[model samples]
Target: MHPFKMLSEYGPLLLEGAWLTIQLSGLALLIGALLAMPMSVARCSPRAWLSVPVRIYISFFRGTPMLAQLFLVYFGAGQFRHELQAVDLWWLFRDPFYCALLTFVLNTTAYQAELLRGGILGVPRGEVEAARAYGMSAWLRYRLIVMPHAYRIAFPALGNEVILLLKGSAIASVVTLFDLMGQTRAIFAKSFDFSIYLWAALLYLLITMVIVRIWRYLEKRINPHLQRRVIQAPKAVKTAVTATE
Candidate 1:
């Protein structure tokens, strides 16, 4: 089949797959971020017991391949199907979509937690001390001060993780989920055209570019100080130019 004709015929299938990819990646990132914050905090705790388990969790997920994690959640759990069914949770394990989601969430959470931990630790001691001087409770200090700073610091890295997760989501095809890559593979199998892969690659690139733009907009919104500097720089330069003239 001609590439354009293949696209016209299968375009809806590809779009549906792309939408699933977006949904999967977006949901995983949201859930991962939520889990990462607490894991980051626990990892930062001074007590060995508190930090050790978190450290291990982070290490295990970060060190292993995402594909292995997916299989572990999907097929590996099949080994205990009787127990899961008895508990009425087998339905979740039986679905490839849910298994892939669980794996993505857990895998992303580990990496994101470490990014958040670094961001938290990067918060200036002076600001924390100032919050303490104001008699802010620990929770208040974290909520009002530390978390704000930490997220700001972590935003760039978190954005990068989101992109990685989005690309990595293609692996969902391995378990039979008809995400973009899965659909592409199916179409290519019938058509035997290499351009189908190129089409899929372009779609992925377009999605990535859109995500990068969204991240930039968010960074501008969150860090008004940087925006202000950007706004003022040209005005300052203009003033100096006028004086010289």
Candidate 2:
């Protein structure tokens, strides 16, 4: 079948899948970001007690594949079914959708927290010292100065992470969750049409383009001072004429 006709027939199914992909990615990013903030702080703390556990958490998640994490949550949890049921938590771990969501959120948080930690460490010591000289409290310094600067430095990296998360959401299909990739696979399996996969790839590309554009727009908004100035001829010409006059 022609690509357009195939799309016309299966467009709604594809759209539904895309919507699920968006929801999964968006929720994971939001919740992951929230969790990562404190994790980043802990990871950067001076005390070993505070930072060591965070280091381990980040290392394990970052070191392992996301698919493994999803599998552990979705399938491996079955081994603990009795324990989970006793705690009234079986409902969360039993559902593929919830398991996928949990895995993605946890996985993203590990990566994001490290990015944020890098951002935090990148803050200039001199600026921090200046804040200290101004008699700012530690909390005030973090809230007013440190975090803002950290986020500014980390924005591009965080945006990249979000894009990666969006792509990674395709793994949801592996856990029996019908995301865009899953739906595409189903269509291909049924129709035996190669064009459907092409359509899915194009849709993924479109989504990526949209994400990149939004990130660029936000970069401009976040750090407008970094934008290049259109250097025109210096007013030196007008100044020379006025002086001659």
Clash pairs, candidate 1, are none
Once fitted onto the true fold, the runs of candidate 1 whose alpha carbons sit more than 4 angstroms away are 227-245
Tell me the lDDT of model 2 at 105.
Answer: 98
Please report how far candidate 2 places residue 31 from its true position, in Å: 0.3
Candidate 2: deviation at residue 88, Å?
Answer: 0.9
- Give, for candidate 1, the lowest lDDT window spanning 10 residues: 224-233
lDDT of 1 at 123: 97
lDDT at position 133, candidate 2: 100
Q: Write the per-residue lDDT of candidate 1 for residues 1-245, one digit (tens) a residue.
A: 77679789888988999999999999999999899988999999999999999999999999999998999999999999999999999999999999999999999999999999999999999999999999999999989999999999999999999999999999999999999999999988887888889889999999999999999999999977766553446878889988999
Model 2 residue pairs with clashes:
none
TM-score of 1: 0.92
Candidate 2 ranges beyond 4 A from true positions? 234-245
